[model samples]
Target: MTSHRRPSSPRLGLAALACGAGLALGGCHAERIVADSYPTTVAQRHPIVLAEGSTRLDLPVGAGAQGLTSRQKEDVRAFAADWRKNGRGPIGMMAPAGAFGATAVRSALASAGVPATQIVSQRYTPAGPEEIGLVKLGYVKLKAQVSHACGLWPDDLGSGGGDLYGATENREYWNFGCANQQNLAAQVADPEDIARPRAEAPIYAARRQTIIEKHREGGDTTTGYRQADAVVSDVAKE
Candidate 1:
């Protein structure tokens, strides 16, 4: 028996419902919760998506297939910026000796605010005549990337083959949460913050001592009520 099936977008469905119910203003928020069931969703992954590691850019010869094209120049700048954001240590740039745009690539790296001293240059030689030349980019950083592959609709949704919950309630498939999780991973600036939080701000010891003294005499600890843009005490006294 042939079964006709139309793919369902959980996000779009929630958006339509929100609009019909006159909740168009807060509709975007409602849409966000529709697919977030990895921990809160029906379908989940084993290792989860947040556990991340190093990512590398095996720089392809996309620009002109010569030294470095404008596109390649931009790529170097972007790569350096990303490296400075999280990854530390010396950055490496490998280019074939006779490549067309090596100077342009070096200039781009400098433009990206990377100190030339921090970069270690290496001569790249092709393995064979047929092999295309490429400038490799790599760095170690705490990357919050997806651990699983998406678009994994194992059984046909229409036929109602596998688990009964999906067919009866029309729930999402296993890979439903992967894309949103991947997006969340990509948006994060500091991935190490996920593993451990940053140190807290320093405390005001003088203020604490003053508050303690006030409390001993049964006085209110709250004292200062300065407005924003207030002048310094020395300037105000003058």
Candidate 2:
């Protein structure tokens, strides 16, 4: 018995060659096409930035008011506390020239636990008649903010300006997720949280001891609720 070997078809060989050439051409075209595909992620496009900025509070003074009002005192206290936490330079207090609230502002800051040496008192000419009695307090502090400006439309979202193929690539536009990034930056309490995590807080030693003792005695280790009604549940109870 003689074995017959089948010859390869020329048409099949030519078809394979054409297919490979087509793929190669497609890849070259893909590389040559100029697509603005940088900053693939929204975070990369609009990153959060930490920078030195000023925090300000304005307290209005009435004609006959002797000192800061109750509301003004609260605002000043909060401002002082925030300054102690994040501020680096001295806290600045600017009051209108000949304003009666100048002394009150200093007293309020001192009452809020701010050192008298750390407060810098200054007087400024009022911009207008309405601002004659306004007291401005501020401090320089590090703040977290978005790097890019929001509400910008550099590129057309629609298939215009020779970007039809780019639109079809399913890539995000230039201003995508900008508002979200800004919101995230604004919501961050500390600017350092963006750079790195903070040190772990100390554990509750008393709570840990209680749990451990309960576990050793084979008693319930879970937290006991004195008022059962405080717990929220949708299931029907017996």
Candidate 3:
């Protein structure tokens, strides 16, 4: 008996090609998903976190000292000014039991425009003889800071590690841009400025009026300044 070979099915060949193409596309898609799992942007990796925090000041008082000295009073005043600007709750003043500087702290805080109701006094037992006259002042306030701590190296920078392929991908390392984020957080004056925009400041009425008057009279709207030697010396000419 003579046997004939079965002809190859065109449909089976097309189906094999289709499955191979599908596998290739699926591999690329899986790689994209894996790459996106890590934070790509600096802000995403090290975000500026707004949270509640406290500010503290420590003042050392001698056993024989009377009230706060002039310098201490100034320091307390500056601290209170900062509290008034950003602090939320009462300003707390803590001292060793039987310490003599509580009255002085209250007086300085009052002089700095802090109301008596806004100041809270507490006393603590001294840890040692050296802490007898130490007075501490603190208040709760809103703070802006980086979420991640600086100086952390989670990955290797060399070519012989697990991150060797990652280095070739031209992406930022884990700790890149952390210092810039930290500095930016430290420079933020108001945490609210990061969350929302401030209200517009009042316009300079006098300057606006002057400019409008000059425009109405067909005069130069641009400001002219009369320079004087007393105001600005012409160092180049001299």
Candidate 4:
């Protein structure tokens, strides 16, 4: 995580920080220099944030449909696909009472790999007449999530407030760049990737054998990149 910088304001006739001295203000704004120099809390620099948490796929239960609507059915199917790939453990079903489209949910669940014999059920209450109910498919898979709302200002910036002493010192006030961390966490599609690298893909034996055979027949091993699909990067090799 990186700290965001606010624009630096001149000291207004005060000493202008030296051009390149270690003690001088860097290219960072004036507030950044102070915030970096003296922070009131560790959270200002390195905050502990949740990388993963419990999340649910909420599917709307429509009323009088007597089952999932076409859109809802497609949604269930999509959830099923994801669950099969990344779900951590057993899938639990949360069914509202008299839920519509019970059969469709069951069918979709079965299609996704849940056995009919092992299907679990629960009672739920419907919120409206047009609504049949909702079926929840949950698994405690390797999900990475973040805490809700962090990096709030620790000290008040008002004049004559209890934290007035904070102003005299070059200390970073609370609530700096908390939203940036939260935003970064939200961009993570898989929390596991944040903590560790992904697993390597399996080799294609058939393709490897073909290449080996071609090499044995005195063919050129080097192949040109596909111009249409090639991805070029300038990153230095480790």
Task: Using TM-score, rank the candidates from best to worst.
Answer: 3, 2, 4, 1
Worst 10 residues of 1 by lDDT: 31-40
Alpha-carbon local distance difference test for all models: 0.66, 0.82, 0.82, 0.61
The residue-by-residue lDDT of candidate 1 on 1-238, one tens digit each, is: 9999999899989968867766545433432333323342633452334553564555556334545556767777778878888775677667665665555666677888978787777877778766766666566566766666767766576676753545555666676667777777678777665457799999999999998999999998987687867569968799
**Every model's TM-score:** 0.47, 0.71, 0.75, 0.52
Q: Candidate 1 overall Cα lDDT vs. reference?
A: 0.66
Q: Against the true structure, candidate 2 has what lDDT?
A: 0.82
Model 4 per-residue lDDT tens digits across residues 1-238: 9999987667632345343343454452434343334456645454434432443665555433466667877777777677666666566677776656566678877876777755566767767765645667665656443343564555557644635446667555556656666666667677667666898999999889888998999997776686664445634442
| lDDT ranking, high to low | 3, 2, 1, 4
Off by over 4 Å in 4: 1-52, 57-66, 98-100, 117-119, 125-132, 146-148, 158-173, 199-238
TM-score for candidate 3: 0.75
lDDT of 3 by residue, 105-204 (tens): 8888898999999988888877677655778899999988888698787777764474654666777788889999889888999988877889999999
* Model 2 C-alpha lDDT per residue in residues 116-209, reported as the tens digit of each score: 9998888777667764477878889998898768988877756476445456777777788999998888899888999999999999999999
Candidate 4, which ten residues in sequence have the lowest lDDT sum? 28-37
**Model 3 stretches with alpha carbons more than 4 Å out:** 1-34, 62-64, 164-169, 225-238
Better of 3 and 4 by TM-score: 3
TM-score, structure 4 vs. true: 0.52
Off by over 4 Å in 1: 1-81, 98-118, 124-138, 165-172, 198-201, 204-210, 222-238
